[model samples]
Target chain A: MKISKEEVHYIAKLAKLHLTEEEADKMTEDFEKILSNFDAIRGVDVEGIMGETFKTTEAPHLRKDEERVFEDKKKLFQNTLDLKEGYIKVPKIIE
Target chain B: MTITIDAIKSAIEGGERLTEEIILQFYKRIEEREPEVNGFLTLCRDEALERARSIDQKRKKGEKLGRLAGVPVAIKDNISTDGMKTTCASRMLEDYIPPYDATVIKKLWDEDAIIIGKTNMDEFAMGSSNENSAFKVTSNPWDTKRVPGGSSGGSAAVVAAEMSVMSLGSDTGGSIRQPAAFCGVVGLKPTYGLVSRFGLIAFASSLDQIGPITRTVKDSAISLEVLQGHDPMDSTSYKGEASSYLESLEKGVKGLRMAVPKEFFHTKGLDPEIADSIRASIERYERLGAIVEEVSLPLMEESLAAYYLISSAEASSNLARFDGVRYGYRTKEYEKIEELMEKSRSEAFGKEVKRRIMMGTYALSSGYYDAYYNKAQKLRKIISLQYQEIFKDYDLIISPTTPILPFLKGEKTNDPLEMYLGDIYTININLAELPALSMPCGFSKEGLPIGLQLIGNHYSEATLLRAAHQLEQEIGLKSPIRKEEV
Candidate 1:
């Protein structure tokens, strides 16, 4: 249940979040309380039950594999924070 | 003219009130109260008025009208709105406007339901208290300083405050139900997959089901009639044949076998008044000729921990799409793409969101997955099976919707665990993928509202709403918050 500040930063990194020194300290404390609550699950014994990934009952519907003709691409491109001529712009990849 | 859905619909059809006039009337009331309650994030006044005018014109031209013709409804910010800002109450997507409508939004429009605005909520639908909203904390209309329970706080608050007639809210662990309980309104979390999740801003995918928050149970049933069904866009959308919720709404609880979970009654932090009110509600059902009995949920204690693990794990995955490239806020000063993502997320996400993400990532991390996430999943199966057994003997399960009454704005904001414990009663239903409805049962000694929850098996929304409507008719606590007119 106890999480160190270093571990908090590591998990935040995995979540693509960068915590400040203050945030990390506070998060470590929050984690202690939260994980302790989550620790209650440890008391539950699951010897026979299968792990239920019970997400959805609906089977994924398959569509015809044929390709469709092109439509205007403006809607998809509109939300991009940065875009160029018919392409999305991202930070430079190579030196 | 009355503001209730049934009354309004009749008035619109009777020519007693035009759709445009109805829109303007609600807008006038909303504008009067928005400054105090902070219920709305964005108001689509012009667009809503235009829609209303069109509906009136259509009816005048002998055109067939939709069931919800000219009724105005608010949507939680997390549900997508085409050409309107869908902020999710996060700085992360503060300026983001979705290009396509969410499946529910399209359905609402098809029914001629007017979209007035988006209601504020906890960031990414994460927190129990509305204070976690990055923009502004929404206040309970009943008490200006108290919270409307979250992450659908504003959605519920608006209905309670009479800012809107009804609203759409997504429930992941009692977000919609608790807020509706606090605000003294009717809220329903339909069976998981009963409604489409096509364009919902995903929080915990498996648990997150979009439902209606309304002033009356009948309105909620009608709203569900429009909101439920299969959609190809959302792979998990239920494919069952659609049925009208109106069919069984007036069917009272006479001879209905109801179970009151005794284990949930006197648990820690439960307000004594709230507990007594729920007991009284059960007694009322008995007086109405229903069979009520006390039952037990042995695995009730393990629900919260398992809920957090699964929900946070799903949230961590669902929220990963908020990187700089596709949409939403991007860091202005990151040289590398990874840095851009990290900084954007860190800056954009609020405290509760960050905590959940970290918790999820830790549980899902290599060494801990089996111990935490996997254990929780097995517990989920156990809990689901136990609920299935209970439903075989009982038509519905009843309990206090939340352990505590609506707290003051900053009371539990500092302690995440305390805020989380508020969801103890409501979370297990989501885990079991059952339909649960919360309606105003009574008020505390101090006059804040308390909710009684009625839960039913999968695809049992009709039964839950029927019980809620029956209770609503007998228990005549019409929100005292609306006592003072705008």
Candidate 2:
């Protein structure tokens, strides 16, 4: 499969990466080769097999929802680099 | 003192060596070799010494000591250790310290194993060579200019350099085995869910498994004994009785049926010397009274493709947590949330990581999801079912752990596809979710080590180790040259 530059740009945008033109060109070649190799899977016949999403034997046991609050939010917030008013601050999404 | 885990354990138990002394020796080795090899990301010197001294005190009091008590083990940087910098060899987590230990780390501490340091890895375990690490490239101890195959390169290099008795490494595809093969050490990637993944920084979660990199198969088995079992914290952990991996070491492969898939051997781009060495190892097994045969796995060729698609898709989602919002590095300047995520990821993650994330995001995107992600998952099931059928006919399968020997640093960095090809022979085992061990079988003319891989049925780590240990004796290859030579 030939990967177009526009497709590469879209992928980079979705992945939150700002790739230079040189990087995108290189990635195009890599993506093409990797996709070609994967084309071998197209020949395999898997009609009735069920999809194995996660390697779990049974459904995950969910803990009952409770209104427990963390007493020490300080440690949790310690690693955050940007904060304002006890909440993690990020670049404004609003225009 | 010898740095193998078994030797260190014996010396400590025999009253001839103190834990403090062994810990000091490892520190000295690190001080001497780490500058050239770039093995460790963070050295826990004071803490290791303190733990060692406590173990010595326990010995003096004649208290019961754990099997691996006092042994210094290096952990791959991705596994979390409380109060220690678990960077995953990426700039994103450079200053972040985990408040709790990973389940594997807690298990090792409970077994009395002292953590000497956290080792380097490919940033987020994305690349095949250690050169992708944001910290530094880990050189093969056998040859300084070449790579210690990655992303678990640092863990394998420490064992090869005698800086640590044993090390823990994670294998998503061929991270653990490829490095162990390159460095001429024993690496075991146990069956998925056999060892808990709790505390391992997620990278392709369904495929990721933590296992041992050691000098000998017995040592690998012993380490697995401590690392395996159910963990309530990791929901994917196996819920069955854990076997004594060490107890079955002496059991020979008398009647075991070993298979060699013809496709694995006859594949293109395989080095001639590596193929011959693997063939010779198979002969040795046949001589040991095991029935060897060639089995057909037509679906094996598609495994690498399916693996990359599934793994990349999962990695994109898994790494989404590092958006500079919760923890780790955050961009100081940005105009919007989208800009913050873009700039932070681009600045903190390496090129290879970004490439994979981009590929994964594309694979999982709206129009392409069916053609890429869904198809890959269906292919994964076919490949797995093929293994189930093969296992019914064969007790184990043997092949070259890696198709090629260690290459010089930067050899394939620009050519990502070439780098991915290095993992061709071993990734299938992970795709099938089976246990596999990579051990030194022979050496290249350049004197670089070549490894033979043994893939086993589910939970058949004991039998796999027995075959590998038997071949280890038969081949009698010298350990990788000391770090000073390179």
Candidate 3:
């Protein structure tokens, strides 16, 4: 269960994060300790238990799928980092 | 002594005190104690005064006032407030002013509650101790040297310090109850969907819930009345009748069936004082004619691992929205879109936030999904079924809110596993998605407050509040802030 720096780097990359060498080293140790403790779960016999995906106390009652006007459209657009012509500007994706 | 919400409401109604004067008095206390406690992240002094004056004017005109008329209430940084910053105590949302109010905030306004300020919390509600906050650490009101249990630390601290009449806090695992226990106030986490989570900043959406932190059980019950209900905005909001928590407050715990899970008493690292306090509280319930029994929830041993895996997995997916997108912080240096997102997240998120994301990513990764995520899912069912069986025969369950006393700052920051293990007592309740609360039972020899948790079945907030109110009367453990005044 000892996680390596390489694995930490791999996980960080998937999580859209980059770690310094020091942070990766510390994270590797943390993963090792936490995963070792989590080994306790390995012994539990969940033999006939069904895995739960979505947990809700009651069934979700969906609202009507109708569009409604947002009165404060201007304020909504103003919070964006960059707004150009009513579109949120971001790093260009097109080549 | 700290002024209770009941006192303020009656004073306003009886023409003895103006709401404005009461709000100003709370601000005076905040000015005195906030520097040392670090509870508030943003203050709304001018707006609070204006609202208080309007409330007074309405009373003068003989108009109907809201339940919380003129009461100044603090909100956790994660809950959105219209035109106010909801930072989640992370640098990413440091300056993010939400355009719309959260459903709970809107409900508070409708009830005539004054918005005092947004309080601090752990970054994205990640850590157990308030030290993980990117801005500053919130100290325990009882003892400034000890850490305030978090990520609802600021909400609990402000109420305990008499800075606000009540505060809203979100609990993913034990955020609300743990901090309330440490700060010696009352905290209640209602049944998962009983309260709307429309604008609560998502941590683990499935497990996350917003609850109240208050100075007394009665105050906690009243706040829940104002906060809970079905909201069209939140699809998962409970579509049932909201119970009258206040009407049942004085019903007492007589003839109630209470269960003390055997495993909780023997949890490793549990402080002896906390254990004694919880046991003593159970005895008090028995003395008041409660039929106390010992029950076994053997699956409890596996709860912490299940909680961490499931919550972290959910958090990893939910937090992916924070990638230098339409809002929040963006890195200044980035060439490509991917680089923009990666750099922005890495630069803005704190250490604990990154750690959880990594853990979650690792758990949900292709190769290890079954061993970690799926296994945790199955364990969740087994654990919840165990509680379902117990609740069928018992009216309530009791345990220590936190296994150990609040530790000093930096004590467990280096060892995240240790901090995670301390949550053993409270994490399972979230897995079951039941209502539970924490109220001060007694104080340790060092004068640190100790709390005992009372748990109830789904949507049984009225029952839980009734039992807790009775215990509050029996134990009569006043707020540590009041002790200071005495």
Stretches > 4 Å off in candidate 1: A53-72, B481-486
**lDDT digits (tens) for residues B66-119 of candidate 2:** 878988899999998988998999999999888778998988988889999999
Docking class of 1: medium
Range of the 10 consecutive residues with the lowest summed lDDT in candidate 2 chain B = B477-486
Per-structure clash totals for the candidates? 0, 0, 0
In order, the B-chain TM-scores come to 0.98, 0.97, 0.98
* Candidate 2 positional error at B398, Å: 0.5
What interface RMSD does every candidate have? 2.0, 2.3, 1.7
lDDT of 2 at B17: 86
* lDDT tens readout by residue for model 1, B1-486: 225778777778878889998899889888788899998999999999999999999889878778788888999999999899999999989998887899999999998899999999999999987898999999999898899999999999999988788899999999989999999999999998889988999999889999999888889888999999888777777888987878798887899999887789758888999989998998999999899988888766688899989999998888889987778988889889898888888888888888888889999999999999999999998888888889999999999999998999888888888888899999999988888999999998899999999999988777888888899889875654444321
Model 3, CA-based lDDT: 0.90
Ranking the candidates on DockQ from highest down gives: 3, 1, 2
Pick by DockQ: 2 or 3, better one: 3
Model 1 chain B: weakest 10-residue lDDT segment is B477-486
First chain TM-score for all predictions? 0.79, 0.81, 0.86
Local distance difference test values of all predictions, in order: 0.88, 0.86, 0.90
Query: Per-residue alpha-carbon lDDT of model 1 for A1-95, expressed as tens digits?
Result: 47788888888888999888998999898888888777888988898988765533444564456686545477666678778887888889888
**Model 3 off-target regions past 4 Å?**
A53-56, B482-486
